[model samples]
Target: MTKGRRRTTRDADHESFDTAYDAIMARWPDGTESLTVPTPYGPTRVHACGPRGAPPLVLLPGGGATSAGWYALAAELSKTHRVFAVDLVGDAGHSAPDPQRPVRSVGDLTAWLDALLDGLSIGLPSGPPVDLCGHSYGAWIALHYALHAPTRVRRTVLLDPTGCFAGFRASYLLRALPMLLRPSARRVRRFLEWETAGGAPLDPALLRLQERAAVLPAVRPVTGPRPDPAALRGLRCPVLLLLAGDGRAHDPHRVAARASAVLPEVTATVLPGVSHHVLPYAMHADVHGRTAAFLGPLSRPSR
Candidate 1:
């Protein structure tokens, strides 16, 4: 409706939404407790797991990816840290779609997140702001939130974040252009295939579910603005940037060098031979390990 992607009409919204929501919930790792946190935009869905008292870590998925996308990583990381994987509002997920208040700017994006955090008791006297981990588009959101609301964040982990350091490659835009122009289950599958081409094959079942959701008519999702250089250079909290060597999403060397030079406290690591599809064995292990260490008590606020 908005571009190449087919927007699911109101008539078909219920059936399609139920199926996609169920599939996402079914695939979640054991012990994940699903909850809906109310926000001004709508009710946001989150998958919470791990010890209640442990330091909290919020997981945000990439463009068109669901909370299920974080299932594997969350399952592994939850052993030490409480993990909450959210289906970003306005995306094709259980989170209620809101075309009315679309997150077109950094202010809009951060406002919705601030409301969601308040709903989750983050930054309150009893609840402290948690660490953030974002992939692709979600990484963009995490970065903005950290810049705009530094006091609420402990640290951040960005995995293959596109658009922060630079723009998407021409090839990426070309491949994605089709889906935005003429969205179909087939094109969605094709895009997934291309994204997972080298690193690791995404879970087949998850891909199938996403394909269905993509074809269903739904509200177009948010497209965040590119980060400003001044904000990127003035981050208050520490951050960990994980780049894949062969990933087309962003230029690894350039992003790392910029992060080292611009950011106050950052650890940049480039995993050799890893692709943009980071959920695979090697990428997941390295990214998760580094994130866990970064999210450890050592990084917590000074009491």
Candidate 2:
């Protein structure tokens, strides 16, 4: 007879987040390949797509997200630019594990990005610099990277970015509390299924893939200190803030207003009828067109 499987607290927690992640991944599917870049910390795996000759645009996903999160947007953007959709080093999806040292602060995350880009040999030629587009927590990382390495970035876009507001709101905390408290796979899967189907219907195959990737064991656990807004004043790149029309947790318009006031070179736009999670779908075309127009004139020919 087969022995019964053991269930422990750690095991339960692991299964929860794993299941949730798998569900989310099931909804967003792509055939992009991966690359491993050797860094002082370790080898970082980056998932990418797009034609090799096109201008480079790096896409970063939200918290607990993978490069696949950019599926809808990258597909459109890649038509005109080489899109490098990266799995945030320590979070979910296919990024290599961090070194024995802990990634505890905003600076550490920025350094990790620098090492990854340097190792990948991106942004050296033409002196044009790389464009960064990040959603949610990834936006925070993008902004921090721009601040840390101003010369390396040509332009930056923050899509429904989190942590840009003065503080995390109560509703956000309430929603996040469940994930923090249980962090279970089943719960996450339910959330993914809901999110995938909750918005305007998406492709069925993409939804299935998102569900599978969400439950993988390799997804990183959430940790580390919160970011400080004081960090925003340090960023010196041309910034674009895209606010979702139906943003509820933090007022997107308010955030955009504040960001525009504080960020030296900034532009803000609100996409009507788009929810935070569904902004990519609603704004993908507009973003792609606008980005191509913005970056085309800026990229310099290699001398």
Maximum-lDDT candidate: 1
- lDDT by residue (tens digit), candidate 2, 1-303: 237967776565556545554554444435556677777555666766777767778988877656765666777777777778787666665566656854667767777788887776777654457889988788878877787777788788888888765455576566656655655545555554444343344444434444444445443433344344566666667788887666554777788788876787787887665566556544355565665565555444422
Q: Residue-wise lDDT of candidate 1 within 1-303, one digit each (tens)?
A: 356776557436557656766765675567789899988777899889988878778888887777776766777778887888888887767888565665666687789888987887765446676788988888889998898888788888988788788777888788889988888879988876886677655666677667767765555655655777787777778889988877776578888887788788899998766777554224366776877777777634432
Off by over 4 Å in 2: 1-32, 125-127, 189-235, 281-284, 298-303
Instruction: Please provide TM-scores, in order, for all candidate models, with all chains considered together.
Output: 0.87, 0.77
User: Least lDDT summed over 10 consecutive residues: which range in candidate 2?
Assistant: 219-228
Which predicted model would earn the best TM-score?
Answer: 1
**Candidate 1 worst ten-residue window by lDDT:** 276-285
What TM-score does prediction 1 earn?
A: 0.87
State residue 288's C-alpha deviation in candidate 1, in Å.
Answer: 2.0
